[model samples]
Target: MYFRLEDKESYKSQEIGNLIRAYNRSKREEAESEPLNLYVEDEKGNLLAGLIAETFGNWLEIEYLFVKEELRGQGIGSKLLQQAETEAKNRNCRFAFVNTYQFQAPDFYKRHGYKEVFALQDYPYIGQRYYYQKNL
Candidate 1:
């Protein structure tokens, strides 16, 4: 067999996801079976912050978290994170993990009780990607 790196956008992503799910389902039948999205909206119903996460066994993986620039530094991100954690705990999640880039909110996660577990430098660009976890 031969392998090459190529980007085919959505098609390629879906193909890889299907392959991995098939492989992992054989090992753990319920890994990431139910994904969740949590969001906050302003009075005008515009989205201010959101988090996309999923559970694997007893752990929660936060895939994405974003807050509007106008809402930053106002504790909205912190409140959203706390609400996500509360929901995860309700689902019996014992720990949670998230990854953020160096230019992103590493310090914010740290303040929210997440500890950096690993760091990969020059990933996807010139900055570092930080992996963090917290015990619920």
Candidate 2:
């Protein structure tokens, strides 16, 4: 057998993810996972902001939350987060989890009641990575 690193968009990367997901599903028959992606677009259909997440079992795992640089500080991120949390709750999710870097929006998640559960220091040899969670 051989192993090779592949770009994130490659079919091999997708196959690896599918294999892991299949194994996980086989282990947890009750687990129901689904994507919970939200996006904001301009009138011209241009992308502005987005929140990507997934729900499985009783938890919502936030993968990414991004807003245009110019649109930052205008509450677009908060709005997207709030909407995702609401939808997760409606789907019977009991908790939400997210991770952010020191230079990223750690305080934003905290402001939304997500508590820091762990921190990895010296991530990227300069900054920290923070893991946060909130009860829904």
Candidate 3:
């Protein structure tokens, strides 16, 4: 739970959001038949950080990641990610992947040995979108 979200889709934000909600509704419909994990962190008894992962075969998608704004840039994100990667490896994951916006920490992932596999430009804003993966 240490990544940021760049709400793209501009004029389509609301529409895209609706679509996401609908998509999530469908995914939730199968929740009872599938495994779900919610990892979270709290401070002063208040939940502040978390991550959600969906797994299939040997892969996991970081469906959601969040860290309180006041807690950013202090290595918390990196540590959380390290934990996620460790967990992925423990589960026999061959690699880990995440999507990031151009304004996000693409360089941060690079520093942690993740390589960019794809990118789309001018999405949500005037920046490069990124998909990164690191082999376990």
User: How much lDDT does each candidate structure score?
Assistant: 0.87, 0.95, 0.72
| Superposed Cα deviation of residue 126, candidate 1 (Å) | 2.4
Residues 1-136, candidate 2: write the lDDT tens digits.
Answer: 9977755688877898999988987887687889999999999999999999999889999999999999999999999999999999999999999999989999999999999999999998979999999999
Tens-digit per-residue lDDT, 1-136, candidate 1? 9887876577878998999988978886565546868889879998878999887778888999999887798888887788888988988999999999988999999998999999999898788999999999
After superposition, which runs of candidate 2 have C-alpha atoms over 4 Å from their true positions? 1-19
What are the models' TM-scores? 0.86, 0.85, 0.66
lDDT of 1 at 102: 86
lDDT of 3 by residue, 31-105 (tens): 211222545466666766666775555666666666788988777777777787777777777777788886667
lDDT of 2 at 34: 98
State the displacement of the C-alpha of residue 69, model 2, in Å, after optimal TM-score superposition: 0.8
TM-score of 1: 0.86
Model 3 per-residue lDDT at 33: 18
